[model samples]
Target: RDEGLHPAIRIALRAITDFAIPFQKSSKLYWRYFLVPEAEFTEEAIPQITAPVIEVKKAKNEVPEIKEELQIIKTMPNEPREKIEMVISEPKKEEMLTPAAKEPLIKNPAIEKKEILPEQILDKKALKKEAKKPKPKPKKQKSDKKEEGFFNKVKERLASKSIDITDIIGIKKDELILKVKKEKKEELLIAYNKRKITEGDIIEAHKKAKEADLPYSILNLSGIPKKIQDLIEALKDISSIEKL
Candidate 1:
């Protein structure tokens, strides 16, 4: 006999104790009894059931085929073709007939052509006019002439004062004029002869000459000494002094 325990209560106990049971031992007991069948549950086998035999039906038969007869054709021999010949006719020439009356031949009028000469082709009068014209002469320039005159005047003035003017030719006029003003005329002439005249010497001389109401031209003649008289007489012929 079994206890009157509810299925839910038994399931709850098994759920709680499931961890305590070994899985391998539970599987061996389940396959041994629950899955295997006993000899009392076996039934006897019935006699073998037989099936009816079947027959295969045959299809309708087709008609018999006949072989076709072939006919052989023979080709006729070809005849040779003939070429046709063409005849060409030559053209006939017609003779020219003469006129009943012949006319007299007339000549054309002659043309008169003139030839032109080279002299006749050009304008002779124009050539002659150009050849007859006179050429212009160049005018003389005077600035250099004036400068030469100024230098000549300076030379004459210096020479009158017994100054050696030849050696002073290349000296600038302005510088020479300045030298004639500062120093005594004799002293300045000496310095000028020695090529040592100062600008102050010339300025003082120019001032003295101005104060005395005399021209620089007069001052140029102020320093003549008796010693240079013979020298002046000897240079007279060869000097431009004559021209001055």
Candidate 2:
């Protein structure tokens, strides 16, 4: 019955303040609770991916098994061959002994021990090189300035010049700022150029470019047809233009 008062707002004000919600509880319960209905996945589908096995085919000629047949055999005659006997001559006991064996071998030791290392050949050149292996010298830095005089002098010289020094001083990580010393748009009238391409392709491109809201170039109205190579001064200047 009261004027200018909503029933819900009036009922809220009449609530007990002593038993009010704590400041911490207000923040936690401020958000409305949402009850998400059980998801209906019956209409949804999951794709099944199957792996395909790839078979590699190799040519039989490429196999290296044929290289193992290193030996070649030839057929011999069926007839039995006669064997020849080598002549043997008996040399005297003194003559039979070699120059080295004559002295040492003649005087047989009480214990005939087998020679473990018969001969050892030492290379003097290799031994000398290995023995003289040089120690590595400590690496020295190219520059270790006592003061910043060199850098200060360079900066002072740059400051003296009228040219901007900030252009050169830059971190490589930053993107390069493209600066054109001289920039101007130039227009050329080529109605009289006799060697340029003037064809239906130019008209088609112009229409398409206009519809698509783009800029297009077309060389047209050449009374006499001429090849590009003829007009170019050098062979290298006549680069192959890529076709779109």
Candidate 3:
């Protein structure tokens, strides 16, 4: 032979017969999804094949499998699982001054508030010291005392003259005319004569006496001495009296 086989291998190659694959006789390791069997159809079974229904069978203890990328690992049945602990870190004291993005969290207190004062917090001692300070009394002027004295004297004199003091209106500048009836003037002279002489010659001496007809007659209203000279010189330097 031209090949490397001996002369006996060349004679055995001439007796070959079948080379077709036997799928039914293959091992289980050689199975594939492409080899699944489909339903056959005949003329009588064509109507049943046109509307075929599919049913899936499930096991009682079947658990759904998860993909390997989810990082889940399977362990032995007697192995214990470790406890997962979480760690939360506290922020530094310096970082709290200027918070993140210069904005404060809603749960944090932004500022401290001052306490308010209660009512009725005033000092009682201060109020008592102010109350103990003496208030000034008003002093009376000298002119007021003099006016009161003159009014009292005038009221006493006018009240004793049988004159209604309320009717004594005012002074008329010491220059107004006085009105006296003639009979009253004669009676005034007679009264003056009685004040001067004895009782029996009093009525006769005034009838022979020369008459001085005056507008007014003052009959010695002062009960001190009943003198005609004091009546003429009474209250000479006094000015007009004022009303209260």
Candidate 4:
């Protein structure tokens, strides 16, 4: 039948069929789409990700480590060429000088001159003569009498009032006046008369009141030492109060 067609038309049709693409038998356009497989939803396999490796280079200016001991050597030319040896020893403590050795080393010129005097260089007979001479006693000073008289009066008052002032020795007049003023003297004397106060009790009372920082004064104590009052004011936690 192709022999009935023109030669050019035959050639054209052969070329068109050769270049055309053939569709599947189950294509949607052919009404057989159910026979075709549904479009697939697939998960692709993932390769593990890793960080790249990096190499560090050492600095060229780095100093090399030393592995040797350091030492010092000294030699003298004029000295004998003896075998030199190294010795390691602990330091030794210097010994104290004896009295016999130290006596000659005294640096005082007066003492040296005194040692050369004829009176200092005594014989056994002269020593015996000096030993036989009567020894003189140290004279008592006048201040000792004044101290004794003051203590005697204090003792008399302590005995009459039955107050223990044993711990109150060596108290000067100024100290006594500070503890017991002239105005407070009558009050202290009255307290003593009632057997409620002792000689050194007032000072102890003041110390306690100052330390505790109580609202009320102890035994009506007043006129606290300026040094103690300043210290109390300097404290952060404790509140300052009127001097007492």
Q: List the residue pairs that clash in candidate 4.
A: none
Which residue ranges in model 1 land beyond 4 Å of their true spot?
1-141, 169-244
Clashes per candidate, residues 3 or more apart or on different chains? 15, 0, 0, 0
Candidate 1, residue 196: the lDDT equals: 40
lDDT of 4 by residue, 47-94 (tens): 223322321112112212111111222233443322112111111122
Please, what is the TM-score per model?
A: 0.17, 0.15, 0.18, 0.18
Model 3: residues with Cα > 4 Å off, grouped in runs: 1-91, 99-136, 141-144, 166-244
TM-score of 1: 0.17
lDDT of 3 at 122: 52
The residue-by-residue lDDT of candidate 2 on 107-185, one tens digit each, is 2254356665533324665677888999787644433231234344334543464322332211112111111111232
RMSD of each: 53.8, 47.2, 39.6, 46.1
Candidate 4 has its poorest 10 consecutive residues by lDDT at 83-92
lDDT of 1 at 219: 34
* True-structure lDDT of candidate 2: 0.31
How does each model score on lDDT? 0.35, 0.31, 0.31, 0.34
What residue pairs are clashing in model 2? none
Q: Order the candidates by TM-score, highest first — what do you get?
A: 3, 4, 1, 2
